[model samples]
Target: MEFKPDWEQAVRRFEAWYAFEETDRPVMIVSAPKAPRQDPPAPGDLLRRWTDAEYLIARHEAAFRSTHYAGESYPHCWPNLGPGIAGAYAGCEPVFDETTMWLKPLDRPLSGIHPVWDEDNHWWQVTLELTHAAAEAGEGRWVTGITDLGGVTDILAGMRHSDRLCIEMLEEPEEILRVRDGLLEIWKRAYSALADITQPVNGGTTGWLGAFSVHRTYPLQCDFCCMIGPEMFERFVLPELRELCRWLDRSVYHLDGPGAVKHLDALLGIRELNAIQWVQGAGQAPTIEWADLLKRILDAGKSVFAYASPQEVRPLLERLGARGVALAVGASTPEEADYLVRMSAEWSRP
Candidate 1:
């Protein structure tokens, strides 16, 4: 069964959510099927596959073909370079496994190491090529998403390694701040380059997160903030985040786990950030359990993007109403996706 999406209506719901206005219903997205698994890569093959333009484009096309887009969901594929690719572009070596990639920490102390963007870097070139190829492949069928560029502190943790960076935050706070300022500029350059390549083909900007915007939009995150206290977060991370928000037309924070909940107040206080995507990590309560937290975000005047089962949808709508909630729901078939979309409309406020 083919998943057909209502493009015009989806855009309307998204624009309403961004403006903190009520829609006829919350934005309801149906999840696509998992791409069929491929055999394990031989030594060196994974890197080769990632860099090969034809291979990357074909893989994306196959996945887009396999699923149905329903309700607020739309088709989008980002080159999967993992979250630390931004750090890799800035002079760190990346280690690749079967499913994802990681950055090798710098061997020297934070004070001695200087990170700069290398245009000729192998990973950087691969990222640029892959993005262009995906854009070409997605010409009429799907949207090409921006790769995971990661946040300022998150990229630094990849280069400096999280544990060492934590210690240095105490020992060399000034040095850390100086490095962060430089990295923010590199991050902006990299994001702008990808956006330039992607915007025309995508028909608008959208990222790994499925929210769509005619203007620029991408998910901003700092998983490392989960490990730090709020004082350190305010001092080191907030300023860079503010600058990033100011640069984008629309932005959403990816709040990863319970550990990062402490910083929500600070995040809500940022006038430029339009929304929050709260991810309650594994082994914890599901999204339904966090209605209070979700309510607080809404109360603070920011929209929310969350995951919920078909069974949980009515309760969430009843509790949170339909003003500013965007929900992603999973279904096994196109018929199921259609059913849920109808149900969502019924549950929504008139």
Candidate 2:
């Protein structure tokens, strides 16, 4: 299946969101199925299938064939070797399972383990190759996304193990900070390399979220923040995050769950941070229940990207207004998708 997206309108909606200006409505991206799609690989071949560039490309094509991308939605494939791939690039061994991959934390002391970016790293080479292959396959069809290079603390957790890293924060704070600072340069370098490889093919930059930016943009996150106190967060995590925000042209903080929400004020204060994508994890109140929190983010003058059901659309629009909100809605049918878009436009009108 081929995709001819409304490139102009998509661009306009996104630009308005970034500028905090009013458009026809908040950007609504709907992915409704047109046909039954192939299921993902079963447990045994999951890692193997993900590593195969041809299989990855073909899988994405087949998935897109079964869906209709409407409103601000566009077809994009974010090539990833899981979130811990950044740690793997820094010499940590990645242990892959049926569903996900994680780095094997160092057993020795922090001083004994050295983290350095190896251009020749096996995972790095595979990631680059997969990126190139996806771009080639997506030519004239879809946009390819930047791989998920997680934040400083999150990557460190993979290398040092989350539990030990927590102890390091208390026992050897300065040393931990030093290691994080050192990794900053490597992170920037890796991002630059991938950006260079993907820009020509994507015509711009985007990430797994499917939002487009004329300049480079990706979801920046620190899942480890949940384990640390606010003081430790400021001392260890915030500075690195600030520096990254300043380095990137555009960025969205992936605020994962309630534990991370405690740092919301600090995150919102960063001038260079463009948006916040809230993931209210399982068993938490649905997306609609967080209207007050979402409102605070908006009132702080930052954009929000969230997933919402059709029933929650009008309420969200009423509560947050439409200036800088983007919703990723999964509609059961194309007709429902069209209805939601129309309703959002109506609610947005002055």
Candidate 3:
């Protein structure tokens, strides 16, 4: 282990609550991994997103500590694999390496409307390896699960050109659904396998939380809603998502950027959801611009899991309160992490 956790009791307490067992520990903070801005950037602006084993470990370690520190906080972190893993099951190709994995389309969706998966697929094997390794590393610190939805909708765009998918929405709606359904079937199997391989923190128990047990928290996700109108999402995308959510536990919907705000209502309507992790999406909003949106979600009676800097805490506590807010901040030393924790506790206590 790269970092030997100093908070073992905290870790056990979190594991208990995460499995939905009652615990006497008090809650203080939330656990989440910071999304690192990739370096040596992807060549050509092809919208490349990548994840490596080391990065995944870092995220898991951070999440374990955050959940441990909070005592009663949710222990959540993703398998953090590459974006194209899901599409590869649908017959696309993903490039893999030590640091990150990426996907480049071999054929357009219209060329082969159907998708296929086998025992030796590159992305599938790589993702499975990374997921297994992450679970081993968790070591009772926190529950580890797979990363993003493998860019589900975006990969569809990459496989079948976005324009083609748009046209297919009308020309071949059934074909689009077939491909989407196939991708989802693979996701369900992956999640089930992951969930089965990893059991409840108490070791395989069936209950309220077990039914929602996820080996990984952020398994399937997409930001494509930012590009399409709400009408398109409601008709083409929403039902597929509803079907997908039914199979897993503790989903945290990723609200990417302001443009995707329109779909928030649709996401909220899904009763199985545990919380919404809102990414204000860079620039000035990381400071204060997101406060309004945070308040809106809290007002809707949903728990909010988001990153907040020390500077943003006062206004955030004033507006959204601390009962259901999760904060992620960068602290260079133990002293700083301690100070921030103390400040957050004071603000959270009524």
Model 3: per-residue Cα lDDT over 75-103, one tens digit each: 54456555556777666766666556555
lDDT digits (tens) for residues 179-235 of candidate 2: 887677668878888889888777778876777887887788999999988899999
Task: List TM-score per model, in order.
Answer: 0.94, 0.95, 0.73
Alpha-carbon deviation at 27 in model 1, angstroms: 0.7
After superposition, the stretches of candidate 3 with alpha carbons farther than 4 Å from their true spots are 1-79, 96-101, 109-111, 137-143, 147-151, 200-216
Worst 10 residues of 2 by lDDT: 39-48
Note the clash tally of each candidate.
1, 0, 9
Q: Given candidate 1, what's the lDDT at residue 115? A: 68
* Candidate 1 lDDT over residue span 38-108, tens digit each: 43333357777666777766665666667677788877777878876888888888888778888898888
Q: Cα deviation in Å at residue 239, candidate 2? A: 1.0
Point out where model 1 deviates above 4 Å. 1-5, 32-44
Pairs of residues clashing in candidate 1: 3-68
What shift in Å separates residue 274 of candidate 3 from its native position after superposition?
A: 2.1
Whose TM-score is greatest here? 2
